[model samples]
Target: MSNMVKIAMTSDLSPGTGTTIEMEDQSIALFNVEGNFYAIADTCTHRGGSLGEGRLNGDIVTCPKHGAHFNVKTGEVTFPPARFGVKTFPVTIEGDDVLITLD
Candidate 1:
């Protein structure tokens, strides 16, 4: 078992929505997709676009800056502009709190 951090409450995030939170000086983006939660690096790999501000279409999120697409579930690059994929963290939901594992 690794160290985990509580990022948000279940009530704070609705389905198909996302929020940004700070973790170890880095911004992490948390998304709620049909009751399941996902977390990834908030900045886009291409030009440092904020993934939290990007548009969410199903499990994929399009970067608002360079139009790059990433899967919230896997943090894989689905579209161009970014040749790399973002880092994904494991998420856990306890009661109404949402937790993310960084280790």
Candidate 2:
């Protein structure tokens, strides 16, 4: 099993916003929609844009590079110039810390 690594404090993220965490060999994007938190691959499937730097409207993220939209919670492609979906990661909250388990 993969170990869960703490990436950021819960206070560090806000509703309708996103952040990036680079761990070992992975780049993860974290999103807070209201009080719920979700995570996904930070790289946009549609041309490698930084999804963490993308715009967030609800749980949908518009890729900064090419306007591809993805669901942060599901990593599903909602609108895209590219057909594939990025990977989604599981997130958990421990006190004020946000943790991710990557495999």
Candidate 3:
């Protein structure tokens, strides 16, 4: 079975914001869309830019380095210069805490 780790609480993330976290040698980006939480790889597929520091427009996140856009909900590349998609993790909310399943 895959192990689930508690990354942060709901209060830790505000709406339309994201945070970068290091877990088990992996860099993960935690996003708060509206009130729901989503997790994705922090590194951009096109370049080694930080996705968490990028701009959040609705569900789409734009890379600040090369302007590569990605959908946080699906982790799909939506813009050019980024042909590959980043890895996305399953996120669950337990009460006021946010948890992620990493495999």
Q: Itemize residue pairs with steric clashes in candidate 2.
A: none
Q: For residues 9-100, could you state the per-residue lDDT of candidate 2 as single tens digits?
A: 88988898998888888888989889788889999877899999999999899999999999988899999786899998888999999988
Give lDDT for model 1.
0.92
1 against 2, candidate with superior lDDT = 1
lDDT of 1 by residue, 1-103 (tens): 5779899999998899987898878799999999899999999999999999899889999999989999999999999999999999999999999999987
- lDDT (0-100) at residue 48 of candidate 3? 86
Model 2's TM-score against the true structure: 0.95
Model 3: how far residue 27 lies from native, Å: 0.4
Which parts of model 2 are misplaced by more than 4 Å? none
Backbone clash total, candidate 1: 0
* Cα error, candidate 1, residue 28 (Å): 0.3
Task: Evaluate model 2: give its lDDT.
Answer: 0.89
lDDT, candidate 1, residue 70?
Answer: 99
What range of 10 consecutive residues in model 1 has the weakest lDDT sum? 17-26
